[model samples]
Target chain A: MLVNRVKELRAKYNLTQGELAKKIGVTRQTIVSLEKGSYTPSLLLAMNIAEVFNEPIEKIFIKREEEE
Target chain B: MRLYITVILRTLLYISLAIMVYDFVRIEQQFELLGRGYIDSFSVNVGNQVGQVFIVITIILVIMNVFQLFVMKRNKRAKVEDYILPEYDASDERSVEITGKAVRFAFVFILLYSFLILGSYMFVPNYFLDFVWYPMFTTASIPIIGLIVYLISFKIIYSR
Candidate 1:
């Protein structure tokens, strides 16, 4: 499974989902799906999100070995 | 505003197409009746309803296009023409991805539905004389059904 710290980092940065989405050049729904783990963002989107959070891509997104 | 306008234009376009098919069938049926000598003259309603509905749709479409054009022209934008054509969800990568999935689902549905529709012709071996409109309507129904399925699938996927 693909895991992300977008929600956590957004909270740390004091940014709403809409603000993060705007910074990442994606829709709010995309961010919602990303946080829910129901969608895997593309590389460009991942890079954009990482940029928004001021973190590396791997730090923001992780590959989990176990299923939920 | 763009999305709403696109949806309205698409609906009007589909309605106009279906109406055109119905009018064609109606005119042909009238000719058949004329050939059979059942009517001394064509009915006054032959093209009136179809024509009026078609004209009204045309007017609405023209008005919308003109309004969009006027607004965009005020901003000195040339992309106003893009608003005239119907398009899939393309606001972002996610929407485009969902649209792709929806289109694929619709394609599969169309293929199966078309096979069933064509197979249904076997049950109506003598359709031309008694049910001429049946074939026309059914044929026109293929794209309409596909579009509906696509829309529903898009809605479901997008919601998820």
Candidate 2:
């Protein structure tokens, strides 16, 4: 019951997954999985990613419909 | 960086092993001389040198082991928040299990190596055995035990 705005945020920044990962000191695959939504980012990672995109945490990640 | 570190460590190990071999040959020759009722001064110097080499090697290996532990701990931390599994796929489970078994197999090899060296010491020759056993047992056991512990935890968590 978690949704992520990974694609939207990446597009807004005009960054590839590898570029984002390099900026954040993580692997490119991490960005791919974030977009796929199969993997959940930890609180720390979510905060970092949100900060990188210059968006509110709530804007970057929303609870799924059922959870709401 | 890891590669460079490993190379440096391996060089240290080799140098220590070579010194150990040199000492062992000296000891054997000195023992033969003592059997003939002659004391060899040069052999005593070689023996002391051998001990020094052993101490140096022990220190190097201990440092290297600590370095490996730090690297592994960092890797685990990075995995925590840095990435996600693409799917809750069966393959992930299988990969974990297969790697677990591989680790267990490596343990068995260590046990075999120890037994073989012990047997050789008691029967054939004692040279080079000391150089081999400490690193073999310590390095192999850490991952073997860690993987086994991880596998047990996974079984408990996922069984439900």
- The fnat scores of all predictions, in order, read 0.36, 0.00
Write the residue-wise lDDT of candidate 2 on B1-160 in tens digits: 3323443444455555655766566567667777877764543654466467668766866776565545545554433211121111122222333334444554665566556655554552444434434443444444444434434443443332
lDDT at residue B64 of model 2 (Cα atoms): 64
Give the per-residue lDDT of model 1 (tens digit) for B54-77: 677677767766775565465432
Top lDDT prediction, candidate number: 1
**Candidate 2, which segments miss by more than 4 Å at Cα?**
A1-8, A17-19, A22-41, A56-68, B4-8, B11-15, B18-22, B25-29, B36-160
Instruction: Calculate model 1's interface RMSD in Å.
Output: 0.7
DockQ of 1: 0.59
Lowest lDDT 10-residue stretch of candidate 2 chain A: A24-33
True contacts kept of 2: 0.00
| Residue-by-residue lDDT tens digits, candidate 2, A1-68 | 78999898899889998898777656565676678875567787788888899899899899977744
Docking class of 1: medium
